[model samples]
Target: MNIDSMIDESRIDDMMENELIGFISTDMSDEEVLAFIDELEAEEDAREELFDHFAN
Candidate 1:
């Protein structure tokens, strides 16, 4: 369930096998990945709100 471990194990090289493995690995319980994306989106939304507030 650890991505650092997964990242280490991931065969991310300049080849088709590496590319396939990267995408395929995502197929298994990508919760942490989704959560990271959600956090990024929330931070972006907050920044936009702050900017608009100050610009007004």
Candidate 2:
């Protein structure tokens, strides 16, 4: 079995869609939105690092 094929693209899509929906529905200022996005990026980076550590 291919490891790449085991990853669920649809789940990622759903998670991103949920985040976008939350962002659109909020009344945050531009700076706040930028900060929120940066936070999300940081969390995603951490998750990727953890996954890589376990994968290796």
Candidate 3:
């Protein structure tokens, strides 16, 4: 999936609200979040199954 099109402020907010995702610090900025996504995407097996595991 295209991360740029797949995620946005609203989606991140929902993830945080539902505790579906976590951050090391509450002070994280949007840039940091995008960087994290980039890091994940760089991994060899960052597949839909992995994402589904987290979503569920």
Candidate 4:
């Protein structure tokens, strides 16, 4: 499935409203923010891999 097809504005808005996502502290340092983004990307990659495996 295409990632773009799986997301829309409402989904983005809902994610923004989510407590865990909404509560990200502005106090985070640049390094901390980068690390957090890297972790999220890694998780997304893993999820995609699992989806692809299952799809086939």
Candidate 5:
């Protein structure tokens, strides 16, 4: 919900949409890509929890 969180989420979305690591290849399967996405979501959740503690 904060601007930085929004930006971070947008960046993750863009990375998945890119379909290329650099300028060449995208050999990853949908499952791998989704797993990576889950990792990002977990990270975001951790950060939000930390922020919530700090806010309190």
Candidate 6:
């Protein structure tokens, strides 16, 4: 069998969707996100957008 056939794509998709929802809803706070971005040294525009996203 092919490697692709051995993987369950639907199950992976469901798990990824659930993780994204959890991450956006409750995993990280605004402060944490900002700290993370700071650690990464993200660009000004990207940081601004990310800050706005967490604010709302």
* Candidate with the greatest TM-score versus the true structure: 2
**Cα-based lDDT for every prediction:** 0.52, 0.68, 0.56, 0.61, 0.66, 0.54
lDDT of 6 by residue, 1-56 (tens): 44653354445446555654555545689897566545444444455577558756
The 10-residue segment of model 4 with minimum total lDDT is 8-17
TM-score of each: 0.49, 0.67, 0.34, 0.61, 0.56, 0.33
Between candidates 5 and 6, name the one with more favorable lDDT.
5
The residue-by-residue lDDT of candidate 4 on 1-56, one tens digit each, is: 46653764346445434633754578988887778767666665676677668767
Q: Which 10 residues in a row give candidate 3 its minimum summed lDDT?
A: 40-49
Candidate 1 CA-lDDT value: 0.52
TM-score of 2: 0.67
- Which one is best on lDDT? 2
Predictions: Cα RMSD each: 14.9, 3.2, 8.9, 4.4, 4.8, 14.3
Q: 1-56, model 1: which lDDT tens digit per residue?
A: 46753443352222334433455455556786566556555655675577558756
Global CA lDDT of candidate 2, please? 0.68
Ranking by lDDT: 2, 5, 4, 3, 6, 1
Is candidate 2 or 6 superior in TM-score? Answer: 2
Off by over 4 Å in 6: 1-7, 25-56
* Higher-lDDT candidate of 2 and 3: 2
Q: Which residue segments of model 5 deviate by more than 4 Å?
A: 1-25
lDDT of 2 by residue, 1-56 (tens): 46573464455546766896777545778888788777777776676678668878
Q: State which candidate, 2 or 5, has the greater TM-score.
A: 2
**Model 2: CA > 4 A from native:** 1-14, 23-26
